[model samples]
Target: MKWKKGLTGMLLAAFLCGAPGVGIATPAHASAGEYKFDFGGGTVETGYTGVSASLSYDSARGYGFRTPENMRNVSASVRFLATGTKSENTFDVDLPPGLYEVSVTLGDTSRSSIAAEGVYQVINMTGNGAKDRFQIPVTDGQLNLLVTEGKEGAVFTLSALEIRQLSSNPVTNRTIYIGGDSTVCNYYPLDSSVQAGWGQLLPEFVNTNTFQIRNMASGGQIARGFHQDGQLEAIVQYIKPGDYFILQLGINDTNPKHNESEAEFKDWMRDMIRQVKAKGATVILSTPQGRATDFNANNVHNAENRWYRSAILALAQEEQTPLVDLNVLSSAYFTSIGKNATLALYMNGDTLHPNYGGARELARLVAQDLKRQGLSGF
Candidate 1:
């Protein structure tokens, strides 16, 4: 919640629209260059500019719906900005180039996927009083937000919005790019999703003041496939010096359908490491965590993808890169907890993926390893 240097503290108010004595008329351009907007055609809250769904983007106004197709006010009393369009919609706000922390207050019954500057700030989040706050490096002098539906039949709604200028120079903030598989990717309808990746939950443990996470992991992605498909290049384009990249893959590679060899996995990972390191950024190699059922008959934890883990460990040693032995750490922990407790961590009875609780625990292990290694952004 901390901003750049020489900035005073500003306590953001929760969205309490239509509440008596809460709405105060304030000038459209507030002091300190901070902007607050109240959506949903409801009574404008104190110190916020009201924005209706119909308010199309105007250059003179500097903020409004740019692609507000079928977007309209659903409720006035509760303050809801609902969009009927099942497809993706956009909203724009003009601002000077810099790093900004956008805080959005979602409606009580809202489910949404919001991406600022193509970096997902909220993915499939839904529930009562859901709030999304994230920092984005804006180089285009404006913030283009993409909003889409989360769960089926659920609409996207925004109750309030607040933009705080974090730094005039976006480079002051470093990013931690994650390259992995579904076990480390983000999920939607996060409030109710039975499955979640460790990368999706890593932000909860990192120091946001120093680093932002961009999890580029996807389902069924192998080391070679991720690089050959140009996903690694996409991340390399944005990665800058002082940034960090974590590569955690291998589970999908073990599938016979992929037909990837252990040596090839190591080679592809090395190539990725070299490309990322060429940008003057640090590369940290992480072995995938163990599955819920990766245990021996003697109750000793064993990793199903131990071959990939061995390859990664060898590469880490050869490249002299920082390593997070998640397989070992997770396996040891699971063994200590016993079979039944470990099974409860996985989604349903599935052994491959971890549920939300499992994801959180995995992220904690990653963070702890980062700190143990004395890496930056712990």
Candidate 2:
């Protein structure tokens, strides 16, 4: 079957005028817009019998000819014109609040995946898609088109794919900025060391197309030093209304040799919270991970370790900021797994830095906390 324009024609026309060979065939008076994206030369594994592909749409970018969705009006479909064999592929499309449809055609077979698509009757900022100025549900967030094949070797090829925006609503855009120590800095020279920080892994959990994640963390820097060195200034300047700031410290702050006292540390954290809030951005506090130590068994070693973990917790409660208690969470997991089992999570013999697994786990924990508080919507 030859591909025909469906809903997203106007948007596709605007996109095509900027690019050569692409064209929109729909009339100008049509209420909705239709878009077509060709994933030529894109190969799928046919050996995997259950593999699938999807269509995705990002207001910041464009549309994903491949993605899957269960919503009635929001979905995508693919037509396999040249098939080498018989195999099934899973298909999905993620769209914003707009209406969408998906139709899959395999040789002589065809199916209309979506029945109806449209816009929301009422809109508000806190609600989904309300923050978008256009009022069209097209997501400024990520629209993932995922294809999964059950078999490892199954492969397939596509002739064409379509994405339609059936609604007039626009999507919202938000940014999240990260600030912390070396544990969270953008580690480069990828192979230099195994030291990993949760900040590096935090972006994977977020929808970057809609929400921007900026990593401003530096290695081996304390809270006061970050502000003095202009890192904080850079972060503050970019922060706008409806943005978020994640402040993670304590790794370098705990160093007594640096002459950073607990009282001074607490003051620094408070100052950061005050300043970030002044910019109208939300603040999230994260505690430092625990060192591998047994307080119950070793009195001398535990007694001499003077970092005030409790003070940070107190500030979180006093300031009413969203807190992810990594120290407490990691300690609980460490205790449950026993000293030897937990060592694999940390990097090298040092108890402070974490390995890849540890960093991933920490990121997961923070994501869980964000979900529990329902703070991600902002």
TM-scores for candidates 1 onward, in order? 0.72, 0.51
Model 2 misplaced regions, further than 4 Å: 1-173, 189-193, 294-306
Best by lDDT: 1
RMSD of each: 6.4, 16.0
The 10 consecutive residues of candidate 1 with the worst lDDT sum are 1-10
Query: Tens digits of per-residue lDDT for model 2 on 1-378?
Result: 222222232233343311222122111111234434432222321211112233333333333332234211111213332221111222223344553333211111111111111211111111111111111233433223222121223322222334456444442246677778766654421223366677767767776665755566666778787666555665565566778888877778777777888888889888888888898888888776666654356221131233466776788899888887776666666666776766777777777677777777777777777878897642
Assess candidate 1 and give its lDDT.
0.72
Q: Which digits, one per residue and each the tens of the lDDT, describe model 1 over residues 78-156?
A: 2223432222355678888887877766664546655665445555555544555666777887787655555556766
The 0-to-1 C-alpha lDDT of every candidate, in the order given, reads 0.72, 0.49
Q: Which pairs clash in model 1?
A: 124-189, 124-190
Model 1, which residues run further than 4 Å from truth? Answer: 1-28, 41-47, 69-89, 105-112, 118-130, 148-160, 185-196, 200-209, 213-238, 253-271, 304-307, 314-320, 355-357
